[model samples]
Target: MSDLKKQATSMHKAAAGLRAVGHRTAKPLQEFKAQSHDLSALGALGSLLSATSEIREGMTTLTKLTRQLEEEWEAEAKLIGEVSDAFDLLDVLIAAKAQAEKG
Candidate 1:
């Protein structure tokens, strides 16, 4: 082969080899990108789980508070009923006393 032709062929082969190396290098980058995407999905899933946990905790606290308020309401209603009955008894006693004095 002519010297110039052999030199050009050698340069071409080197360039082809470099392109192959570049392609090989790109494989890891692509894998890294895929892994990064999966990590992002995992992060999003973790955030969703955290949000759900917070909501569950809030619901539990609300349920407990509601039960406490219901108990307080029941107690207040019972006290009001007892006070009303006591007042009724006082009225009857007053009427009896007045009728007895009218004799």
Candidate 2:
């Protein structure tokens, strides 16, 4: 419920969404690369195929990084939630102690 937790949650959600998008694109990118390899028989078109292959490789790397980032974000969100709960508990304990002393 703290600001850090809220921001962490938002970041985690965004990372998850990006990771999903990356996953969705991976298969299509692989298919495109395979098809492009067949087009390599066209001589000049081979250059295009080569470029497409490079793009596919880049996409693969990006997808991997996205997945990693998603995991990190999720961990951060959990840590933030734990820290927030600890602070809330501390506040409650302090209030209780003050009340006990007054009574």
Best by lDDT: 2
lDDT of each: 0.54, 0.61
- Model 1 residue runs over 4 Å out of place are 1-49
Residue 30 shift from truth in candidate 2, angstroms:
12
Clashing pairs in 2: none
Candidate 2 runs further than 4 Å off: 1-46
Q: For all candidates, what are the clash counts?
A: 0, 0
Q: Write the per-residue lDDT of candidate 2 for residues 62-84, one digit (tens) a residue.
A: 65675676567567656655665
- TM-score top scorer: 2
